[model samples]
Target: MMRIAIVGAGIVGLAAAHALLDKGHQVTLVDPGNNQQRPTDGNAGWIAHMDVMPLASPKAWRNLPRWMMDPLGPLTIRPAYLPALTPWLLRFVLASSPARIKSSIAALRAINAEALPSWKALLTTLSLNGHLREKGILSVWRDRNHFLRAEDIITRQKNFGIPLEVLQPEDLKQIEPALHSVEAAVLYPEGCHVSDPALLAADLLRLALERGAVLVSAKALAVEPANDAVHIRTDGAVKDVTADRVLISSGVWSRALAKQLGDNIPLDTERGYNATYAKGAFGLNRPVMFEGEGFVASNLDTGDRVGGAVEFAGTQAPPNHERTSAMITRLKRFLPHLDENQPAKRWMGFRPSIPDSLPVIGQADKDKRIVYAFGHGHYGLTQAAITSRLITEMMEGKPGSLDLTPFSAQRF
Candidate 1:
């Protein structure tokens, strides 16, 4: 059996570790002790198949000014960093062209299509639903013009056999009484939600430990390909870890580690903010997306978590609790009855994003035994299992379950 080292503990790393272990491989998961590293604890916990489009679409450019200037806006980009990311933005615009978007949407849809089956398999194996609600996700638009604009993209998405239901304003009102202000809604039947992603990951960690995988609280400093194994150096000590494979699923930090091995990926973190109300604002039967606002909400037994914001500066940016409060403010507009009196537990985490807003998933080089499963942006929760199975397949000398052409490291 091949020995593999996975460097991250987020959904991707956990998924990879699970897949590797199932194949009878020796796996070691390394993560820095809770300080400067990315945490998988704070996401809104969605496994959506409807959000198959890249963040850098035509509409992004149109809304750039407002997203940048308004701190409370759903999307924000630091103006100081714009020049450095201009080339990426240009490429994003190019990729959002009619032809490119069609192709991207196709690939994303394929990845998304694979998500449900993989999730079902994992859920069955784990025997813990832990709020694995298949209650569909709905995207609501405030005006007919917005829905009409999205219809073009929706038509192309339909070609991929995605299950989408377009709802009129009146129909949307019945579905989401809290959102009558919206003119229309698109319901994605295949979307999934997790009440608590952290609890889910904690369960996965428990399983990994039970399966003999070691979780080290040490930070990896560097790696060098030694005689037949890759020698890993951590902050504590240098250890000769002879592994046949190394999968980098280290989120935003993966870029630096991968760069150490001659891969240059321009990865930026999408700093996200979330607030959890211990007592739900109102009874939400499912997850809801506010399109024009770029925000989302979910009702869970534990509480209602309202979140959304894409500020691309760095994950370490100060916790702009004001932004989190603004999300609550925005929600009040949609669901007037939502009780804002409950104590809020605010959270922020960095989602590593590429310019095209696609994750990097594939073998780094044919000659080397390194694989990449990082830069998943916002879809890490959605694409975890599929990426794990694909990466594990590649490591086992078996063909990857899907075409990895779309998420190659060379694209950067």
Candidate 2:
């Protein structure tokens, strides 16, 4: 058996650890802990298998100017970070071309096609089937024009063989009574979501631990490759951990570590903000994406999670709870009964994003012993299981079914 070390204990890292452990690898998960509001803890846990489209689309670029006008809109970029973000923004614009969008969709769909089944298999193995909810997701629209414009995209989704249902105003109530009357809604019947993201992360880690996987509760400082082993230096009392292989899955923090291994990946952070209220407060049978608003609300076991803005602020930016407030303010338009006075738990996390919307998931350099698997962005939860399977196959020297070209670290 090989000793494998994973640098990030978020959803992706933990999932990888579990997969490797099931394959009889001696796994060690290296993370500083979730005190900094890990993305796994705060995400609107949608297993978005049908969401093959990338955010960097021609339509999104066209709406950029108007979205930027509203500071608290679904997409925001801090003024001070603009200069540093220019390079990434340029690539993002390039990725929005029709050709690039089509390619991104195909690559995303390739992985997402197995997302649900992989999650099911993993969850079944872990005996945590109840954690995943397949109630599906509703993409609701308030504006009549916006709803009408959704037809083209819906047509495209149908062509992809995705199970989708268009719900008119009258049909909305039967699907979700909590939501107020809307112009229209499209439901992805195969879409899934977690009952509680944080709990899922915890359970996955706990199960990994139970299966003889070690949890190194320290921040990885550096990774050095020696003759036969990769050494990981960390901040914990145990200064270093040596392993036969190392998988860099540290989310947004992975860029620096991958660079150490001679791979300068163009990974950036998509700072996401969210607000959570007491359980049963915002009643919803399934997660609902408020189309055009750049936010989604879901009823989780922990509470009702709201807010999902794509903020371009760097990793060090302070948490902006105001974005959550704005989302709540606008949400009242749909859920008029929403009590704004209810206390909310605010959170912010970084989603490691690539300009092309594809994750960097392959060998860092010539050494196949070290693999890179991060930059999943919003689909991290949805793609984690499939990523784990692919990376396991990679580390085991087996030829994986999916093409690694699109997810290569050097693609940038």
Candidate 3:
């Protein structure tokens, strides 16, 4: 069996490690201090096969101003950093072209369909429940004009065979009896959700331990590319570990390490803020999203979770707790009965974003014994399993189930 090292213990790394083990490789998973929470824990927890478009869409561009202004806005690029953020933003607009968007959505759909089954299979093997349910995702539109605007994209989704369904108010109520208010909602029956991402991550790690994967609680200090293997350096006086291959899945911090391997990926972190309210305050039988604000609200048996926004700032910037509260407040606006003042929990996690809103998932330079599997942007949770499976196939010197060209490391 080949010996391999995986950096980052987030969902991506964990999934990669598990796949490597299945391929009969001895895997060592590494990570930093876990000083910060991972986005895999706070995301909307969707595995959406129907919502196939990248975040770099024309609709997103049109709403950029509203998405940037209010500190509570969904997509925020700090005003002071506009000059610095222009290139990434510009490339994003360019990728929003009709041709590229279609190709991207096609790739996304293939990857997601390949991923969904793996998630269920793995979760079943681990005997862990993240409260995953495949009742699908419903996108509700409060404004008729917005609904009409979204119809064109809905057509695209239908063309892709995305299992689309437009529900009127009565149909919406029947499908989601607990729903408080809705003008219209479109359900993607092929979608799924994990009620709690934190628990899922922790449980997956536990299962990895049972499968003989070691988790050393120290940060990776450095990695030296050797002729036949890669040597990993850790904190304190711990001896360096050597492996036949190294995979970096360190999320937003991955770019720094990636630079060591000769890649100049334009990776920037997009902080996603979330508010988790105590049990039964808000009502939702299925997930509900406000496409305009990038806000999502769902009912967990224990509580309610409202996640929203994309703040292009680093850990250096203090989290805007008020911004997280805004997600809850915004949800209240959608459902008037939802009490805005209810005691809620707030948190923020960074999602590493690339210019094209696509993850980098391939090998690095030949001189460097490393492969990249980071920069998943808003869809990391949605795409992790297939990514791991793909990386594993490549590591085994076999072809991956699908083409990896679109997700190449040098796409930037």
Candidate 4:
């Protein structure tokens, strides 16, 4: 059995550790404890399999000015970080080209199609199937103009065989009475939701531990691949470790570590903000996406967690909680009865994003001993299981079922 070391304890890393252990590998997880700012802790928790479109689409590029003009709009970039962000933005523009978006959609769909089934299998293996709620999610648009503008993409998604239902005004009211009058609502019946993503992540880590995988609390500083083993340097009680192989799944932080290993991946951070309120705060049945708002509100068993937005800020920048406040303020228009008085927990997390929206998931330096599997962006929660399966397949020297060309570490 191979001795594998995984960096980052987020959903991707933890799921990978569990998969590696089940394959009889000795696994060690290196993470810097669980911080609220970690993406795994504060994502929208929707297994959005139909989210195959890349964020850098032609439409998104056209709406850039309007989105930027509105400081609290769906997408924003800090003025101070604009210089550092220009390169990524330029690449994003390139990726928005028709050809690139088509390829990106193909790549995303390959893994996304397996998302729900993969999660089901993983949860079943862990005897935690109940953790996954297959309740459908809604994408609602209040303005007829917005819905009309979105028709092209909606039609494209339907053409791709994604099960989608266009609900009428009266139909939406009967389905989700909590939502105020909406012009149109599209239902994705295949989407799944997890009541508490953090709790589920803890359970996955616990299972890995029970299976003899070791958890090292530390921040990985560097990754050095030698002839025999890969060396991992970190800051914690355990300073360093050497393993037969290493998988870098540390989200946005993976960029530096990958660069250290001769891969200049253009991985940047999409600083996302979120707020969790007491149960029954807005009383929704399932996750609801505000069609044009670039955010979603989900009714979790624990409470109502509303969040989403892409802020092009570097990882080190302090979060602006004002973004979360803005979402709540806008959401109040839809759910006028939304109780802001309820106790709420606010959070901001960095989502590791690539220009094309496809994750980097393959061997690094043409070496099977070193692999890279970060950059799932906002869909990390949805694709984590499938990614783990592919990672395990690669580590086992078996040909992966899906083509790795699109997700290759060398793609960039």
Candidate 5:
């Protein structure tokens, strides 16, 4: 059996490890451990299969000035990083072209279409199906103009075969009584979410361990080709390791390693912030997306987690907790009755993002021994299982069901 080493212990890496183990390969998962800023733990936990639109759309450009003026806005880019981000920013602008967006949407849909089935199979195998809730998600828009503007994207999604149910104010009230300021809502019945993302991740890791996959607590520093094998250097207890193959799924930290392997991927981290209120603090039944506000409020097993916000700061910058506080403020304004007295938990994490909002998932070099599966952007939680499945298929010398051309590292 080939020994495969995967870098990163987040959802994607763990899922890939489990898939590789199931294929009877020897798997070792490497990570720094104590993942205080893991997106898998801090994300909104929504399995948003219908969220196929790239973030670099023309509409987003129109809102850029407003975001720049408001430091606490939903999306912001630090001034200090702007100069260094010029090239990537230009590519991001180009990726917003109609043709690129259409191609990206189609590519996203191809993988996201299998979200439910893949999650079901993975969860059942891990015996953690109880963590998932398939009650669907609600997207609410407060402004009439915003609601009308969303219709165009909704129509496009419908044309792409996504099922959406547009709801009036009354329909929204019937579904979620806590919502008061919404002009309209849209329901995607196929959507699902994890009740406890942290617990689910732990369970996935537990299952991988039970299946004989080793977990190494070390930071992967670099990777190199060593004849038919791949050599990986680490920073902690296990200084180095050599394996038959390596999969780089290290989230925002993946770009550096990819560069070392002859592929310069333009990857940036989307600094995301979140806050969780005590359990029973908000009696919301399912995840609710505040469309214009760019946040999602969901009731998880632990509490009600409000997550969303994009900061184009590099990975090393100290997190500005004000972002989390801003989300809480917006949540309070949305639901006036939410008890402010309860203790709320706050967190910040980085999401690996590519200019086109598509993940890089294929062979990294000409040798094909080094593979990459990172940069899922905000949809990593939704795409993790299918990504693992595709990686497994590729590793087994079989073509994946979905087209990998859009996700290839060479695309950049």
Candidate 6:
């Protein structure tokens, strides 16, 4: 048995801890404990196994200027940060090539192919199955032109073996009567979502604790090699910890720590915001993604959550609450019957993003005692279980079921 220290206590870190414990390892998880800063608490919560397309695409590049001009659009890069962000931006643009997109889709599909089964197994083992809902998700388009443009994407998804069902206006109304002004929709029957993301995370943490894993509420400072073990420094009373292995899964903050281990990874934060309404504010059976608007509205346990946006603002910038308000405005336009007077809660969090829209999940150093597992971007929730399983396999020196080269930290 080995002693492992995992930096980060969000879903990814907690999931990794659970996997290590299942393998008979002693785990200590460290986090800053700032609930507001954690994306797991406020994400859209969709388990989108069928959505394997990378965000950086030729279409997105063509619309970049328009999106940049419209500050309230789905994607924006803060002008002040553009100078320092040039390198990452160039990489992002380069990743938009057709070949790169095809490669990314194949790699992402490999990971997503195992996502549902892995999540189901983990939930069953942890006895937290009640937190998930398998009603599937709907992607709706309001404009006929926009709907027509999605044919290529639908074709590609079909080629990749993703099950899809096209829905006309009447069909869409029958599936979600509350939705208004939808021109068309597509349903991915295999999709699922968490009813309450925060509660689900709490349940995972509880299960980890029950399995003899330790949770340390502190900020991780740095990690270094110490003799045959890995040394970790944190802000808690037990400031230093020595472990047989170390896993860096600290989300957006992972880049700096990986750099400390001699790997300079190009990672940035995709700032996302959300708005939640009262539970009874709207009636919806499943999560719906507004195609052109680039946001998602899902019925959660607490209420209906309207979330989606890709802002290039750095992690430290103050959130622009107007983004959440704009999403609510768009949601109201989509569902005219929604009560505008209902109190809404707003939140913003950072998603660790890479130029290729793929995660970095591999060894950080030559010794292989330290591992890197971050840069999951918007699909973090969907890919967390598969990532954990792969990490466990790597730590045990076993060949993982899927190829890890595509997601290797050395790829950068």
TM-score, one value per model: 0.93, 0.98, 0.94, 0.97, 0.97, 0.97
Distance from true location, Cα of 335 in model 3, Å: 1.9
Q: What's every prediction's RMSD, in angstroms?
A: 2.1, 1.2, 1.9, 1.2, 1.3, 1.2
lDDT of each: 0.78, 0.88, 0.78, 0.88, 0.87, 0.87
> What digit string (tens of lDDT, one per residue) describes model 3 on residues 66-142?
66667677877676767777877788778889888877877777787777888877777666644587767789876
lDDT per residue, candidate 6, 174-259, as tens digits? 88888888788999988899978888898888888988998888888989787878888888898988899899999989999999
Clashing pairs in 3: none
- Against the hidden true structure, what lDDT does model 5 obtain? 0.87
RMSD of 6: 1.2
Worst 10 residues of 5 by lDDT: 58-67
Give the TM-score comparing model 1 with the true structure, all chains together. 0.93
For residues 191-305, write the lDDT of model 4, one tens digit per residue: 7799788889989988889989998999999988788788899988888888998999999989988887888998999999889998888878889999777789988877899
Candidate 1 weakest ten by summed lDDT? 32-41
Residues 70-174, model 5: lDDT tens digits: 799899899999987888899998999989988988898888888778989988987888989988888887888877887778887898788889987777787
Better of 1 and 4 by lDDT: 4
Clashing pairs for model 2 are none
lDDT of 1 by residue, 1-412 (tens): 9888888888889988888888899998887747433546777788886666777676666667766678678886677767766766677667777777766776788788898788778777778665488888988877678778877668866876778898767777777676646667888887778867787888888899899898877677776676678766777543544577888888988878888888888787778888888654655678888876867887765678888788766654576777888878887877887777778888888888887777898766533688889988888888998999989888888877788888889875
Lowest lDDT 10-mer window, candidate 4? 58-67
- Point out the worst 10-residue segment of candidate 3 by lDDT: 29-38
Backbone clash count for every predicted candidate, in the order shown: 0, 0, 0, 0, 0, 0
Model 4 stretches with alpha carbons more than 4 Å out: none
lDDT of 2: 0.88
